[model samples]
Target: MTRTTVTARPAEPSVVARLSALDRWLAVWILLAMALGLGLGRAVPGLNDVLAKVEIGGISLPIAVGLLIMMYPVLAKVRYDRLDAVTSDKKLLVSSLVINWLVGPAVMFALAWLFLPDLPEYRTGLIIVGLARCIAMVIIWNDLACGDREAAAVLVALNSVFQVLAFGLLGWFYLDLLPGRLGLGDGQHLDVPMAKIALNVVVFLGIPLIAGFLTRRIGERRMGRDAYEAKFLPRIGPWALHGLLFTIVVLFALQGKTITSQPLDVARIALPLLVYFALMWFGTFALGKVIGLAYDRTATLAFTAAGNNFELAIAVAIATFGVTSGQALSGVVGPLIEVPVLVGLVYVSLAWRRKFAVRGRA
Candidate 1:
């Protein structure tokens, strides 16, 4: 006799739904976390020394373990099946990809070269920082913006796979094109040749990515996807956050004097990041509306356009040039500015929904 197979039910609406994606408002939580972190770093300036020195096998724990915790959930959520769908939309994807990798990096390079003081090492680090396409955290922004989660998933996975290969050339271009802006032949700039950039990519991106994928597979086979996210994954976030907190504390402690000294330079780097985010947010929205995308699809495109994977920025920055270095420091500063900015953009998306009512209707 042949037996028929039964499909399991999807999870019922629970607190997650009740929270109304906006009400759950992870952006607020992230902002609050950063606020607490800043307060702690300042009030307890000495805490940074404690969290800064985590090493195993001559490598730091942030790349080794902290990054694994950060990326696992994204891997767990991957639906390779969705990517193969014949009805898949390409307009949104193409627009987002072009803007993110092409427009975004080029704009960053030009703007940084224009304004950033002549510090070659700093310039190279900044360029490497810009070359990377975001991977891990942008999804949260997508969800908050009420985006097309499926599309977001596909593109994020696709970008993560591609960024590993592209980062080297992009990193080189930032330095080579922005000559004199980076103070060529300076001690700091001189060290960041091509080979080091490649090595840093493998250490930060390759290792955590492969490990996260494997571990995500193991967890799924064991507990099922729903159970794994609700149970194991939430537990991991706090620990990862704790690791981040520790790292921040150490970073602040190490730079406690410098932060006081270089507040002006901090302002310069921050201005570009802020503008980059705003441009990406609005630029994507305008294109989506022009294309007459559906509400979810437009939101997905805008989120992909607006937000970035600053987590990778931090890890790569630290591994490549030491966390205390200015480039690394600027990379760390990204999320400090990104979280609040994206939350505000989510609100802006909601406000502008009416402009593209066709996209919003569905």
Candidate 2:
């Protein structure tokens, strides 16, 4: 008894402590990138015009490249063989579909009208943002938050399908039919061609998805699952963040003047977006927990529901309305608000995970 020795359990690392340097300072880096982009756009006279000219099938080439880079690594990390498990979860699938397709757009519609009643152009643009579900960048956010990769991939693919089929119809309903029925506007119709939406889905989601699938298949075949996951994934992981930063820089640079010049308008546009993101993220997360989803799938559901396809929204805005239009400006203001907000949500998701773990142990 006198010689008895006791071992104390080591304390778990805090969430912030566990993060890599890059992930830890994501907000600071994003803010810096935004500042740099804005400064460059303001300082360099012809930069926006130059950047604007580089387009592939009506999408900005630089932005497209950045998205592809950002998407590939996370997509590659998915265990494609296990996607069947994700698909078979009808509750998760149905819940995501309802939240994304039905509730999400409805909430944005109410918020846009509530917040920006006087500004029809901004209102319409926000409605358009609502219609475009997250397909590309939500994956990055999901990965960062340690959500189920396969579930995200499935949900993204599902949204992409709905995007091609329903985006135009939803656009008409929100922009044309609903407003007219409600006597909100002068019955301005927004015709978002299905072909354009289809093309975007192909380019943005399809290409990278195929690339990621093939990369995983080939890497696993060549290197075995252990090596592929342990060795190969680490090398490519950082590029996702790199691509995110690069996209932000280019995006802010393109809209720097507009963003800087129209501070009041930006603030106005930002308010509804802030409200919408908070509602969707927290509400969906709560819903997920209520439905008995584990933290991983719950996090996946929340992120996919919360994030918007700003890429498509911006492209649709610019293509339908002039690049200089309020619609396009509203679209530009989207990612500006979304980036930091969602990044903050990533930490929130992590904290919630820790809390749940502690409760389980108790």
For lDDT, the strongest prediction is 2
Name the runs in model 1 displaced over 4 angstroms: 1-28, 43-46, 55-80, 117-123, 177-261, 315-322, 354-362
How far is 230's C-alpha from truth in model 2 (Å)? 1.5
Task: Encode model 2's per-residue lDDT on 198-222: one tens digit a residue.
Answer: 9899988999999999999999999
- Best model number under TM-score: 2
- Per-prediction TM-score, please? 0.69, 0.95
Candidate 2: RMSD to truth: 5.9
- lDDT tens readout by residue for model 1, 148-188: 55577667656665575566556555555445455543232
In model 2, what lDDT does residue 71 have? 97
Q: lDDT for model 1, please.
A: 0.58
**What's the distance in Å from true for residue 63, model 2?**
0.3
Q: Candidate 1 at residue 255, lDDT?
A: 45
How does candidate 1 fare on TM-score? 0.69
The window of 10 residues in a row where model 2 has the poorest summed lDDT is 1-10
